[model samples]
Target chain A: MSGDPILSVDRLMMRFGGIVAVNELSFSAERRKITALIGPNGAGKTTVFNCITGFYRPSGGAIRLSHDDGRSIQLERLNDFRISKQAKVARTFQNIRLFPGMTALENLMVAQHNALMRASGLTVLGLLGLPSWREAEKRAIDLARAWLDRVGLLDRADDAAGNLPYGDQRRLEIARAMCTEPALLCLDEPAAGLNARESGGLNELLLSIRNEQGTSILLIEHDMSVVMEISDHVVVMDYGVKIAEGTPQAVRDDPKVIAAYLGADEEEAIAVMESGT
Target chain B: MSATSARPSHAAQPSGSAFIVKKALISALVALVLFSLMIGVRTEAGPQGGLIYWTRFGDLAALVGTVFGGSIIVELLRQWWGPVDKDSIVPKPVQSAISFAGRWLAPALLVFAVLVPVIFYDQRYILDLSILVLTYVMLGWGLNVVVGLAGLLDLGYVAFYAVGAYSYALLATNFGLSFWVCLPLAGILAAFWGVLLGFPVLRLRGDYLAIVTLAFGEIIRLVIINWQSLTGGPNGVSGIPRPTMFGIPLDNSDNGLAARLGIEFSPTHRLVFLFYLILAMALLTNWVTIRLRRLPIGRAWEALREDEVACRALGINTTTTKLTAFATGAMFGGFAGAFFATRQGFISPESFTFQESALVLAIVVLGGMGSQLGVALSALAMIGGFELFRGFDQYRMLVFGIAMVLLMIWRPRGLIGHRAPTVYLERNQSISSDLVKEGHG
Candidate 1:
């Protein structure tokens, strides 16, 4: 991996009234690597994710994404929609925010909206069913089908996204994010409600995405097994502050991380860390 | 064990006979008081030149007796049918047959619409009434793009209708343009207004958006009224040219359509022609909407409707999605407006009022949001039913309100509750509206 960081979040602070949800947080996710932000409940991991994804403007900070093409974007300056469209930053919600009424194929098609819209000549040519627009639609459906196949949901492409089983929906969400062709993918609690097997499936999906597409991923995960197995770098937070940042193994062994997040003293924390996690 | 009371009782559950009878009696008494005032007394000018009331005890007695009888029958039916409704099931084959008809109903209605004016060519009243119904059908379809597809509650849709009407009116009268030339021009002008109105309210949503649109509609109407030098105001612009076949008008001139076609010079020819024109326009609206629904922008519109947040996350620019929906819908409204101008040969601000907006919205809601066939069906039912009940005068609105309430209670999702998913893989499936969530985007 290149030493240059793809995303650099500097002194990020988010406040809701008097309460600081994210306080002067700083972290850098390297190019084409899986980065995990882990913390206890209300440790501001999601708040940080929201800030990065442009769902919420940080009270103070700079979130910069430096492209391989040598162009850099200040994500905080862009609107929520432009963050995804222009910045090439795609994200999934903690609670699975798929378009519930649309079919699974349509959910993926919707992800490719900008590409299809441009091909449609901003809808005029599409209305006339022009050849170029038809070709774009065919290509979009092909891309959607390929993603569906990868996610093992090709058979259920006609089913509504809401009708998909939980595990499949999780996979579909990743596939949807992939359809956007983002340079950086952010996932919030992807394995939050998954069973052991589903969590394993998610780990494989995230790994394959990184291996095949080489897209950098920034994720907030509660499931340590998935995080430990997939994450190249781990950042641990407590009370809106990053307490530990290192490789997964090093961060897992961090005393402050265990004391604050795992609720263990130094001695017991060492024993828990040594349990081959 | 007492926690059962925490959960409210099921209102649909069977009640005690004594309780039911008591409830029915109360309803009967309430009906008695209401009908008493309506039917009990007749007011007339007295010999001394003052109003006097004459009591009609027989009429009051008959009304009270009817109420009691009606209430008892209703109570009995409710008791008997309540459980049956919960338990009833249709035979498999019959259910399939109904589903088959439901699937084909939209095309069937289109066929029926094309055939109606022809079948009633001899009856000018029926043709005229059908024309009116088709006009509302077009308006409802246009509004469906904004309200049904985009989930934008536009209470001032009549503003676009006014813009369309006035565009055709002013153009035809002032510039002496043909109706055909002005039709698309009116649509374009209305779409421009739609964008103009859309820009200021890009950030607003739901009820606030509705209120703003309502204000814009009133502003347009007030402008048309006050700017009499341009629009002719309350007196309206008259002698507007009617849309003709090529250059031949639907008139008794030697070069007119009746003369060219060697048909009788009856006014019914014009009514029939107008009916077909409006029908064709409504179908075009339906076609374009259906085609748009499958396109990228159209899917964006629906995605925005379902979840605006998710739409933004998906990288769909919601501002453009919303504005395009407004412009497209307004264009259709303009087309319908131009047709209206041609059909009436006159235009007035009174024609484009809040009441007109309400009527079109009622058609869309009563039909089923986003369902083309449902809008057409509802327009026919609402507009034709109104014509049927013309003799009732003051009671017409009251009866219409009750019908609407009953319709809502019967089918909350609307006449056609199933939503056809825009894209499908294996087979096209109609989604139950209960499964479709709106305004979450």
Candidate 2:
């Protein structure tokens, strides 16, 4: 992959009137790198993903994606489909957003639908059930199976998405997002409630996505192992403002990062968290 | 692309799973089919293949078998080719024929239905009521859009019905417009009120929307009542021009249809003509409604009903979707209303009330939301069944009330309910969870 950041955010701000959820946060995620945005709780990392994915319009500033094909898209101006189509930005939610009633394979296939443009034709009404929007549904299943296999979830692909175990659901969420073949894949709190084994599975999956697929990753994760072990670049945030950015080792050494975790009210808790960091 | 992925080796296959499985399934399906066939069989031998050839069982089996069989085909496709994965296995043109017949059945069914009265009934009065049942079927199909597919729950549907009747009555009487011209005019004017009613409730949803639409229907009727000079007050504008076939009026004049056609003019022929007219309008309503449901706008509607957030996220403007539902539903209502005016040659505000909306809503709900067949069944139940109870007028409304209550308790989601949605149907690989999984989709 080219050595350019797949996503460039310059002074992004998201506000709900008086409360600024994410403030003037600027960062660049390099190509094919698992970049982590870690912060104490309520650090507005999810907000950043929402802005980039077109779930919410940013109040100010810009988020841009530099595609491998030499096209630069300003995601802030684009609607959700445009963000998904033009920028090729894909994301997972903090809580999984599967079409719960749908089966696991169907969920992934829906994500791959934008790639199905080759199949839209008049004589193909029989394929309305076929969802011929994409030629790669079989390929999509093959891909979904591979991803599920990577996360050890190939067996549960037939189950309703809602019926999957929590860990499998998280992995399935990641798999669903990846089905879009996004240039920049953003994860929202992927490691939140996973057990150690599941978290390890997530870490390896994220790394494989980066290495095997050459996809640039911008992940919002709280688990230290996932963030520090897999991430190439780490950005630390506190209450919506960026406090530190660098290699995991360097950001782990920053004093401001320590102070930010020492935080507004939970200075003692921050001291404890920072001491571990 | 990968057929091997579909059938994995070493999975536990059911024991004795050979031709035994085939025999078992066929026998079960035969049993089920026979069980269904038994319902349509008449023990009383009533009228030798007449209207009494219906059993609640046949209708029930026809509906249930249709649903399960449709899903079975989907399941087979999923098994054979890995997965259907998309919405259509065929193209739009292939479905057009089925959809065309589905839509045009109103006219065909209407023609066949009109023949029923002339053949079975000796009384002309019963023919008039049959005409009325056919009219409501068209009306239910119209209102089904707003309340059924779109999930808007409009209670004031009858207001549009009244508006069309009045528009035709007033325009025909004052402006002297012919039946053919006023027919379309009535629909347009009714649609205008539909839009007017739609605007105020743009932001309202669910029960609030229901209450507002109910009130709006009442408001239209009240306006018709209080607007003395325009709607001819509560006494209603009468002496409306009769709808003639081409230039030939069905009047008993020397220059009327009898003289022109060189056939003996009977009032039954006139009723027959009106029956045909109502049938045409009804067929047009069914045809247009079905086609609309398959369009981009219609798909957007189903999407909106599934999850409003997902729909908006897909960039569907909910406002436009809701308005279109109102406008389309009202357009059909207007068609029915215009026909009503022509049939009666009169109009009144009394016809457009809260009761009318409730009846229309009842039809949509009972017939099954978003299913064309469901709505037709609902209309058939409400109009046809109610007409059947005419000799027991004292207990007609009571029977309707009891039926609705029992129906609500038994099948609260409405008879057929909304479809299981294509996305789920296309991918659900479960062979056993079919029965319990009915309402969740």
Candidate 3:
């Protein structure tokens, strides 16, 4: 938490035709910390995640990603794939997007495509089965194996990813994103379909990633248990605008945060309902 | 309790015989309507050059009766079989047996292929047919890299074939280059066109990509036909030089290969040499593809096929992945085309039509996309099967169509539906085709 901000968002805005999906929003993610973005449905949490990950170009704002080596990237200018490649940012979809036909190990191996592509000399050396390519391939397999082991899917390495259980698929996806060795991991609802126990396991996994790998995490979650327990900082949004932002404890106690989740005071809700009727 | 009392639903079920009769009657009615004109009526030119008409009521009735009987038999089999499950039509034991056969089929076919030339060296017809089959097998393998491995549906694969053929034809006829020298040049030229095709269609997917590629093929063919001065237009280029055994020409002259080796002269020597030549080239294509599947780029291609969005998210440059796939597949097509030009000693726009592309694509699809053995088997079945139906006269196409339809119904994903993972840990498992994405582009 004390390190320089790994990612800083300045006055982000996203407009889809006439509707403003995100309006002049700003936030910063501290290095090696788990930051939670919590909002009710249709609050544009995922949209912000998309903007930061380069899936969408923000209408107005600058996303700056600073590396430990003193290099700063303007993510907004980069293409979708380059965000992950050069900017060192990785993300997982709310709906799992694993390469279902490939094996679990292959899913991880594919995530290491950039590194392996270079080592293979853009496939010319690898096509020749050169020793250099062989060593690179072996090292890639080892890295994939290590990530698979970390996610506890080492035993099911050869199984098609589509055949894995729901909980395992979620963890496998996270492992795949980590295989890219990203400086920041953005997850959209990692616990969306998980049971209580699986969410507990996910909490431990996310904690270990931050603790051991020193990778910053930004996650959107409806699961309060996940948000409250592991998040060092929390930002709450309501109707595409930031409602509250602070430490998890401070955000939880904020009246505005409670109003956004539980709906405004009783009188205010009744008045709003009367007007609608 | 009595069986009927215990399960009242059983009593409501129609008897097997009655159900079969009802279904058969419906089929007979439909067949009667369909064949009333098709089989019952016929028209021909009379002796005076006027039209003559006749009705064959007996044949129409016979066709209807056959449909009725066939429907009854099929219904009976269905009842006896308990239930029809589309996914598991072939029982587990039978599937395993097929897979077990598949395990050894590759090497066995290789052994048989090696011996075909020797066994049929005396028969010119068999040798020519074998060369045709090998040429198609090579084409199927080439297109498999794009449509199968990379999941790019290319309806213009024949354009690359034409490019290869024309490259060799132009180089050999105009510049007096040998086939050996022009072969690689043809492949390179085709690969260049492949990359060119890759650029404009980079953003297109699925059906749009297919339409654009189809148009590309037609454009190439039309260009060849209209460019009369360069391509000889519809007449085609003839006397294209034949391939030689290294530097030795396979001819009857005193300076020929047979004379240099001190062997007796026979036209069969050149045929045998051509057979082995195409065989070696086809094998080269197969070997390179197999090797590529184990490389990073190959894995990236598969990854792109599985989920392009995921590939992009994982930092894979999908544009280059697709371009490489097109280039590689086209290069092989070029090689096959060069061999074809030399083998026939002739080339024409008619030879590189949409039908040729469709035929090669059919071999790849029927063989199972991404399965090397499947493509090879499919090519053998399709090309050889078409030739087998030669005696069917006008009914040849009808019979071939029925066979293709039956094969598709039997194995919807092709002859081999499952994909074997390129690299595996612990134990290798074949993925069901259901999970394999056909790719957006």
Candidate 4:
């Protein structure tokens, strides 16, 4: 898990007619680490994630997920369900895609729908109003309750998910993904609406998940505190190019990383870094 | 992580006292229905005993329960749960719709149902019209699955109806099959046809699906018309058997039913029996459908109807779901068709036309796309009303057009349109708490 890459994406490209949203991006995110992809607006950060998650079929790239047989297969060729269920990649949305019409508990349970499919088995079990379906339904509810508790939302479990406060909705989105028990969790803008306290709690939640469940995290966050405090390794990009990658401290000082963040040319970037406010 | 700090407030939430009262009202209404139905049956049928007594009471209870229960639960939802759900299983667009339509449709439906019958007293014509309404109710329920639940508009649904009627006609004529046995066979054959129709339109959507299905119906009709050997062709098949009592025909011949039973008989008895038979079939249709609605697959169907993309993302196999709807719905349509063949004892290719599909679709939509009771009411109004209007001669279609326009303007979603129960409870869960219009809003 330390040196071996779990997800290796190479030379990924997504072209819409003439414009390239993601241009030849390449990176490897290893197991059980908080890897941050930081870039300015329109830097193709989210597009790259979409390609890996199989929401978009990349035009030219190899996204290989390491398997138990010590081989890798291209992820881009897989369907969305295959990426989610087979590749074990769970994701949240930029706009908080909780099923608004369902209760919070149901939203969480739907995330674990594939698990319930086993209870509805081949024998006369599911057809006869069998105890197995009942048991499975109960188990699903219990698991949802546990997740709600983890997210500090147990009291609001029965509430319609749309009614939740903005902060709780964010937390529930994360809890819903964890219900899938995926190998790689992709969070798109988790820290978008959070204040200092909520952001801190999010940081703590990610750190605990990484430590306890051995789950690798790939997060897109604009919050500097969240990105810098929790991220073990940061990949900085600008104008669809990977400018620098290393430990946070080293990348923070790099001329290219500084230029990218400041939206400046390299020469102007060095002048600002040299003046050193 | 959200900016909504401070402990979440429950200040705006309503209490549950009203829930109890609503339940009480429902129970009382059910009791009244039992009492009224029994009195009505005793006064009308001139005798009372067996399941009719129970049925009279049971129907009374069900009618009372559904209405009282529907009203109480809704009021409680508003008072206790908030008119616009902070979070509800209904989509936002659908919720806004239910709210907008509910404001006027309720009173208009009641007024029309009561006033129409009172103003028209032609009993002979009314009975004929009532049967028509019942037929459409059956058809609407069948089409609801394909169009409303599965979101598949089928312009060839009448093909399955034709199959049922033709199968019953052919089998009973050639081999002398009983109505009961032929009934199941008709359903099975129709389901087969449904699946066959389903395969061709798997990739089609909207108008494309509609056109292909229309072509399928036309193909079936042409085959019936052109098949010179098996089918009688355009002249159609006649002298088909009417429903009988143990090989005894209802005619007043030497060995007919009256002579065998040694009792004077009227043709109306058989008509009544046929009525009961179709009534039972319609009830069975309703029961099975209601049960299916409670299943996970049923919920998934509704979810799919709402959003196909989200349904797929949930890992539901859309293909299987669509096929099941087609098969199940087609089976019911066949059952109705078989009954039609047995009753009329003749069928023609002319019966399975594009207009038949339009009538059924109208029944489904006018009753509110997914409402069972609504469908039944719409059937009664459209078909029964149309039949009753026979005395008007040439004015029937005009009345229908006027009524339809008025109905649309009054309740655009159709009568008793698609409304799912707002509250779900365990078997032992009492309705005592649902008495008022206020609770955890």
For each candidate, the alpha-carbon lDDT, in order, equals 0.87, 0.72, 0.90, 0.72
Model 1, B1-441: lDDT tens per residue?
364454334353657877777876787788778877787878889999999998887988877777777777877887676443221223456446647877797768878888997788788788788888889999999999998888898989999998999899889988999988999999999999999999989689888898899899999999999998898889999998888877888889998888888987988777877888898898899889999999998898888877888788878888888999999999999999999989898888899889999999889888888888788889988999987787989999888898999999887767765577787778776665665655521
Kindly report which residue stretches of model 3 are placed more than 4 angstroms away from their true locations once superposed. Answer: A1-3, A265-277, B1-22, B44-52, B84-99
lDDT of model 4 at residue B417? Answer: 44
- lDDT tens per residue, model 2, A70-135: 888888998755676567777777876655544576556556544433333321432353455334
- Residue-level lDDT of model 4, residues A1-277, one tens digit each, is 2486778878888888998888888888877888888888888888888888878889998898885457666788886666776777788778876655445666676666667656655212544568887788677778878888888988777665656889999999899888878788888889999999999999999998889888899888789899899988788766776777777788778876767666787678778557644
- Chain A TM-scores for all candidates read 0.94, 0.88, 0.95, 0.92
Fnat of model 3, as a fraction: 0.72
User: Which regions of candidate 1 deviate over 4 angstroms?
Assistant: A262-277, B1-14, B22-99, B260-264, B391-394
* Number of the top TM-score candidate: 3
Q: Each candidate's TM vs. the true structure?
A: 0.90, 0.66, 0.94, 0.70
By DockQ, the candidates rank as 3, 1, 4, 2
RMSD of 2: 13.7
For model 3, residues B1-441, the per-residue Cα lDDT tens digits are: 997776665566565688889989999999999999888998899999999999999999999999999999888776666543344123467557767877788889999999998888789999989989999999999999999999999999999999999999999999999988999999999999999999999689999999999999999999999999999998999999888887889998999988998999998888888888888999999999998888888888888889998888888888999999999999999999999899889988999999999999999999999989999999998999889999998999999999889989878889887778888778766777878877888
lDDT of 2 at A76: 93
Judge candidate 4 at residue B248 and give its lDDT.
Answer: 71
| Residue-level error in angstroms, candidate 2, position A170 | 6.7
Off by over 4 Å in 2: A1-7, A29-36, A52-92, A96-219, A222-234, A246-277, B1-115, B182-200, B253-260, B390-395, B418-441
- B77-146 in candidate 4: lDDT tens per residue? 6666533423223455755665565555645654643443344433445444544555667778988877
